[model samples]
Target: MKDLFDEIDTHQPERQPIGEGAVLLRGYALQLGKDLLPSLHDIGAAAPFRHMVTPGGFEMSVAMTNCGQAGWITDRAGYRYDSHDPVSGKLWPPMPDAFLDLATGAAREAGYPEFSPDACLINRYEPGARLSLHQDKNERDFANPIVSVSLGLPATFQFGGLKRTDPVRKFALRHGDVVVWGGPSRLCYHGVPTLKHGSHPQLGSVRFNLTFRKAL
Candidate 1:
């Protein structure tokens, strides 16, 4: 059987509008792939990725870690941003310059020029891991945009309207694709479906998502 990842279109970078304020920048982060991966490794070595439990006591399928000033966390206490890693009991690793540059550049390309993210939630998805449709509302400001970069295996991205029941549009997100949404689409619901089994040259069988947000 042919691998699913082999079918993904390795296209050139281009700006694609998915909503009023949301854009999928195809192949936007391809140039940064080399630098970003190594930085991700260092950050993971520092904080490590672990499955977090939701306030409802359900364990999340995705393994997560973070960099920057704050990290988004969920537990019995509820979903919120914390400055320290819950497991390490220390401040999250500093956001690398390459991460900030890529996020800022992508946000600008998506028409959010002033976006300066302070928190980066890194989610690692293995086969069968999925995320439920949800809104990112834990941040202090909705004026800032959300910048998400995809790496490794390809996955389906679910972007919906403001309501959970609203119609959702799925997009095939491959390595180096970046999605930025804010303004009218800042609070839109979004998620990932269960990832299919696949392997990548760099990341093996895992996929990584770097979500940048302004959480001060």
Candidate 2:
């Protein structure tokens, strides 16, 4: 598998917001609301969301699905990548151009310079769902930044440093917000705070996230 950077490198333009090594691009998807949900539904139809059990035998609070060449998985067997979806024995869903474009743009904005992603992990957070602080360390490469986009109800994003005990900067993310962090901050700890019970007129009570990565 070729890095998405191979195809998206020369297209990076200085159009996104940059901060230190991270970048925050806001309202980048508001114009595509009509298309985004349906596209996500198509992806779900292909790779359906399911709650995964962690190595510790605890069910992960978040519901997840995937699109692209690989999907992140955790279980008693530990974290790893597989081309076939365990639930369906079929190839995982394909990442749409919209997802790819968004990820590439956000990553470049985050100073990755040349960003290309092969896996897009789509996570769904309903009321009460929360992910504990953790580092993204299972990917085949750390040179790529993780591009995360939010949709639906607002969520509190916790961005911490390289250490698990590091203090975190919490940000309130509403629908259509995109956050990209890489470089020295790529392995920094991060997670969503407990989701508040609420309903978004557009997406009901569910919050959706698209996390772009380069996994093979």
Candidate 3:
């Protein structure tokens, strides 16, 4: 209950960069947080998180699901990347080699080396969930690099820029924090803001992000 790398080796997480091929490796999954929270609860017991709907139909308060070889989805014909699991159509839960070696070792420690992610998604905030800035551009290659990975509670990311009114920079993600971004910040405009009310002794009030893309 208390050894998530003991306060991350008693301070010294700093990697933080921010743009141009981004960075933020802080705590880098805190020693793999006991193997990435039981392989993300066994890939959510085989893809079972929901809240999707949004091609203007509007419904997504952040509950999602996924693994590898594709995942991120949405409805009304939009937001792609799907290898099935349009709700148990199956085939969407297999990427857990500790989530492909913690997203290929956090995209080679934020420098993007052999990062072979296929897609991971898996968000799941709670206290008034919210993710707005945008610009992931539905994968298929933005030159790769988008590792994300915080685990429970604590949010506030919003790294904006490259348009949409630019100038953002919130940060604060906690639990294992990873964030990678990509060359030219890979289309920048990040998000995740409205999640407050806490409690996380191991994911209590909830907040489990993950992201990791390379979606083909």
Candidate 4:
């Protein structure tokens, strides 16, 4: 099965539109993958990834961190964007130029131009880590698109409708793939299924996701 997946992983990237205003730019980050790694390393070092507890006091299995003017965080206060990391009580690391550029370019390619993201949430998932279906409503504006970049191990992304019970469409997201959704589909529910154990040539035993949003 690994061999089969590996074989299929070599296929060329393509643009896939999943809904009225959502599109997937497969392998869109391949050209800049090398630059992303070191940038992530530095950012992670400054703002190490850690599992956060929800408002209900449930710990999230997926570890996360952030960069840019504001960073997404959750605790007793609830899920919201903050300029400071609650852990260190200091300002979050500034978003790397490379990250900003990649996000802007990807958003522009997906029909959303002039996107200036103020918050970037970086998620790290290991085997068994999963995210339930939810909408991104914490941001101040819904007009700007959400640009998400996938890297490392491949995973299944669940893109659902406005309601929680809406039927979902799963997409195999490989390293370097970028998913962008906004406008009419901005409030759609989406999530990541449990990650299967596997190793990629570049990243071993882990998957990194970068989601850019215009958070105030």
Off by over 4 Å in 1: 1-12
Model 4: residues with Cα > 4 Å off, grouped in runs: 1-13
Rank order by lDDT, top first? 1, 4, 3, 2
lDDT of 4 by residue, 1-216 (tens): 232123233555688999989999988887553467778999899999999999999999999999999999999889899999988998999999889988999999999997999989999999999999999999998999999999889999999999999999999998888999998999999999999999987678999999999999
lDDT of 3 by residue, 54-167 (tens): 988999888999888788899989989879888778888778777778788878877888779887888888999898898998887788888888877888898988898979
Give candidate 2 misplaced runs (Cα > 4 Å): 1-19, 31-34
Residue 20 Cα positional deviation in candidate 3, in Å, after optimal superposition: 4.5
Taking all chains together, each candidate's TM-score versus the true structure is 0.94, 0.88, 0.32, 0.93
Q: How far in Å is the alpha carbon of 45 misplaced in model 2?
A: 1.5
* Cα lDDT, model 4, residue 63: 99
lDDT of 4 at 152: 87
Better of 3 and 4 by lDDT: 4
Task: Write candidate 1's Cα lDDT for 1-216 as tens digits.
Answer: 333233345575788999999999998887553468779999999999999999999999999999999999999999999999999899999999999999999998899899999999999999999999999999998999999999889999999999999999999998889999999999999999999999887678999999999999
lDDT of 2: 0.80
Backbone collisions counted per model: 0, 2, 0, 0
1 or 3, which is superior by TM-score? 1
Assess candidate 1 and give its lDDT. 0.92
Please give the TM-score that candidate 4 achieves against the real structure.
0.93
